[model samples]
Target: MTRLGNARLVLDNEIRPGGVVFAGGLIGDIGEIGPGGDGLDLEGDYLIPGIIDLHTDNLERQTQPRANARWPSRSALVAHDAQCIAAGITTVFDALCLGDIGFGKARNQTFEDAVIDIAALRRQGALRAEHFLHLRCELPAEEMPEMLARAIEDTHVRLVSLMDHTPGLSGQYGDLVRYREMRRAEGLAPAEVETVIAELQGNHHAFHAANRALVIAAARARFIPLASHDDATETEIARNAAEGIGITEFPVSLQAARAARARGMRSIAGAPNLVRGGSHSGNVAVIDLVRENLLDALASDYVPGAMLEAAFIAAAEGAIALPAAIGLITSGPAAIAGLADRGRIAPGLRADLVQVRLHEGLPVVRAVWRGGVRVG
Candidate 1:
């Protein structure tokens, strides 16, 4: 058994000074500091549940660190897993893109290789965090349907998000001119940006409905949780709800988030949004969602460490209590991802925990343990 004392335990609904005891990879007890325990003293740090990140594209960033450079798939997978573990993420859904709209052909290559790499690492017992797949399907891509068919059967695919990145249609790039500018800033010539935009619009017009149907059918058949990415309106939320999508990722406006909540769908805001104090894309600020009680959870999105920083930021803002704020990265996400074994400091639960030290309003992970064993 392992006992950890002298820490503030962040529970599901409250935070209290206590300790945790675990054995056989499960929590054995949790309460006040008990007598005669063979464990380490945490020295009054904060003990929170190990973070569960539902959607992170950090792996993609690691794989393609530069515009024209690609890292080896297995090496990138290891790097990604290590970064997640160091960030106190015990459970991570490596969000991989399944389709491309005439750009970033390398994303398709990384997608194909990541599945094999993750499977091999798992079989070899080389992974630190428990990794799962979150397939981000591009609804307007011609190959999306076929690509998804190849991965939906994989055991690691726990979450599937329907992503439509077609400019001026839906999602982050709702304004065509803004999308064009963004592309141009990425070094695409003005003509190329306009051409790419037109091509994407054409793809959306030709393939969006059929691809969305295929994705929905596959997700429903497997009973995996479905998420709608970048929902921008009440009508979009209603359509997703009618299609049985229970989560709305990064809704672009307060109305859409509120509508999602009204429909019993959880609204996920990017952790970076909270850390940066606003959305980079000029979308709805997460603090506004927090104030309105429209936010259910916070996803890392593209940065693993942003999850921890955002949780502390939310608490510091007084928008929510410390425990509830922490929940945005812990139990809230675990529940959303259908993981019931961890995410709380309670007996009989999986002992996935992290020790955090607060320094000048910033929270830093000091140590981490997964299933009663120290992993970081």
Candidate 2:
């Protein structure tokens, strides 16, 4: 058995000084608030459940490290897995886009390569963190149905999010001028930018409703949980709730988040948004939602490290207690993803935990153990 003691245990409801013992990949016991452990000594640091990230674009970032610099798929997967482990994440749902919305033609290729790379790495025992696929379906893309058909066949896919990123999508991206500027910054000529925007809008008008129904049907058929992305209004949230979408990912406004809560849906915000104090795109702030009791979970989104940092930041900001803040990245997300076996410090649960020592008010990850095996 592995006995780790002298640490602050972030339990489901509160934080207390305690220890836990584990063996055979399961927590054998949780006791010993005082010192006297036979194995590892935590030495007064905070010990919490390993983070469970349900949506992250870190794989895509790793796959394309720089502009025009696409790395090998398997190599990028390995690198991403290492990053996740170091970030104290035990389970990660890699959010990959299935449909190309003209801005990123490589999304389709990235999705395909990631599926194959994840499987290969798992077979070879090369992954440190548990990896799963979260398919991000762009409803306006014409190829979404065809690509989703191939994607859902893979056993790794566990979640699907419906998105409509048609240029100037009202909620999260209401600034059409900003949209055109961003595309132009990407080296697109002004005329090309306009042309692409027109094409995207046309596709959205033609296929958004039909493709949405198809994606919802496919997800329901497979029993995969559905997330609605960047919802802006109560009506949009109500429509998603009626369609049986159980999670609202990155709600764009307070109205949308309140609607999700009213419908008994989970609301996930980006951890980076909380850590940075506001949304990058000028949407509803995460702290405001926390004060309103509207935010349910926090995902890494693009930066895996933001999960741990955001939890501590939340606690420091006096919005919530440390244990509840930790839940935003751990238990809350795990519950949203329907992962019942991990995400908490308790007897008989998987021993996926993280050790952190706060330095200058910043949580620093010191160690990580997944299923009772030290990985970082």
Candidate 3:
């Protein structure tokens, strides 16, 4: 048994200064004003639930830094897992792009294979953090259905999202010049860029229908959570909800977010957007979503540390209460991912917790525990 005392415990809906006890990998007890026991004292620091990250592309970045710059799957998985633990994330859904857009390094079969191999390694006890899969389906890719079938059948996929990046369709890549610049930075030749764009335009309609059906079928068959990425319009949000997608990730406008809420679907925004004060892609501001109470959760899309920081920012900015802000990283995400056993500091719940201290008005993680064991 282990006891953590002298901490501000962020409990279900309130913050109480108390001590928490853990045994058998679950929270044993929590009470106010407890004396010293045979465990460590946190010295009045903040004890928050371990972060549950639902969407992150960091693994894909680790797998391929640039075009043709591939790293070994084992090394990348180990390094990614370590980073996640150090960032205070006890649970992570590694988002892998499943498509063959033929424009960047992430469009290759090796990306899919790496996901399978990493899941296998994690099952063999070679990973530091609890890992799951979130497959991103690009609608214009011809090979999307096959990849979705393989991922769903593998049983490691817990979430799947429909992402359409066709230049004019979703407005996500509306700036064609910017898109070309990004492609050029990846060393794509002019001819290759033109060819890929032409192919995407030519197959837009057929690919959209096929990918949408595949996503819905796979999610229904496997009972996996389905999400829509970068929803830009009210119609798009309605269409996705009608197709049984229960989560809206990074809606481009407040109208779309409100539409999602009306459909009883959660609206998720990237934590980095809140930390940076706006979206890097020029989408809707996350703070607006918070103020409107339309946001259900915050995802650490690219930067893992942004999750905790955003929560603190929301509290400090008066956008939400401390407990509500913390939930965006903890219970909110865990519930969205269907992880009911974690994200709360209560008896019988998994002892995934983080000891943090506020430094210059920002949350600084001092340590992390996963399943009653110190991992970072």
Which model scores highest in lDDT?
1
The lDDT values for all models are: 0.91, 0.89, 0.84
- For model 3, state the Cα shift of residue 56 in Å: 0.6
TM-score for each model: 0.98, 0.98, 0.94
Model 3 regions lying over 4 Å from their true place = 33-35, 66-68, 105-110, 184-192
Candidate 1, 198-292: lDDT as tens digits: 89999999999989999999999999999999999999999999989999999999999999989899988899999999999989999889878
Show where candidate 1 strays beyond 4 Å.
34-37
Per residue, candidate 2 scores C-alpha lDDT tens digits across 1-376 of 7889899999999888889899999998887656763667899999999999999999888888897898999999989999999999999999989788886777888988887788888999999999999999999999989888878978778899999888876555567888888889899999999898889889989999999999999999889999999999999988888888999999989989998998999999999998898988879999888888898899999999999999899889899988899988888988888899999999999999999999998888999999999999
RMSD per prediction, one decimal? Answer: 1.1, 1.1, 1.8
Worst lDDT window (10 residues) for model 3?
Answer: 102-111
**Off by more than 4 A, model 2:** none
How good is model 2 by TM-score? 0.98
Between candidates 1 and 3, the one scoring higher on lDDT is: 1
Tens digits of per-residue lDDT for model 3, 249-275: 989888999999989999788999999
Cα distance off (Å), candidate 3, residue 225: 1.2
